[model samples]
Target: MEVTPRRAGMVALLALLPVLAFGIFRTWWAGAITLINVLIIAVSLYLLMSPTEEEAHEAHADNGVENASDEAL
Candidate 1:
């Protein structure tokens, strides 16, 4: 799914939850888990938010290649 502003906000909240829980509960392990989760969420957000123009162009280019090869057959 594309990262709309709402979704991005939700992800930010999700990343924050673990840290908050760790802080409130004094759980070191939770802190580690939170760090890992934040990294994963950050990457997912980046991918979801970035434009897909290159991928779209590549898909169209691949289809053209396939159609040209089919015509030659």
Candidate 2:
């Protein structure tokens, strides 16, 4: 089985869970911030990694609109 970039990233992230858990256990404030930051990063990565069909269609539509405006100018 071939490992994809996303899968590799997830594995790497899982490896860090113990460290994050330790940090949270040591200091509640810093650990909370770290957890939130990690979650934000994960969500951002998820969004960046996938291109939805609607997004593709919207991109094409935007290009068509731009071309139309350029022709009008």
Candidate 3:
């Protein structure tokens, strides 16, 4: 499992969405904040489904350890 750079970037943006919305709501307007929240949620869903590099590395490491253990046994 690995996330493309684009997907990672999108995930980061989604994670920051709530903070951006709060700032906008406080200083500028509510409607813009609401729209931003909706967009963030949608993007977040996509990011949540995307595979990450950490997951891939962990999986590879797990498999390697398992193979090593089997060989020792």
Instruction: Give Cα-based local distance difference scores for all models.
Output: 0.71, 0.67, 0.67
lDDT of 2 at 71: 81
TM-score of 2: 0.48
Residues 1-73 of candidate 1: C-alpha lDDT, one tens digit per residue: 6557456746665767768778578878778777777867777776677658997777777843457557889
C-alpha positional error of residue 54 in candidate 3 after TM-score superposition, expressed in Å = 3.9
Candidate 2 lDDT, 1-73, residue by residue in tens? 8554476457546635865876867887777677677766766665666678897787877843456657889
Off by over 4 Å in 1: 1-14, 53-73
Candidate 3 lDDT by residue in tens digits, 1-73: 6776566657656646676667666765664666577667757766777668898877777843456557888
Best model number under lDDT: 1
Q: TM-score of each candidate? A: 0.43, 0.48, 0.35
Cα displacement (Å) at residue 73, model 2: 22
Residue-level error in angstroms, candidate 1, position 63: 23
**Model 3 alpha-carbon drift over 4 Å, by segment:** 1-28, 55-66, 70-73
Estimate the overall C-alpha local distance difference test score of candidate 3: 0.67
Question: Alpha-carbon error at 23 in model 1, in Å?
Answer: 3.9
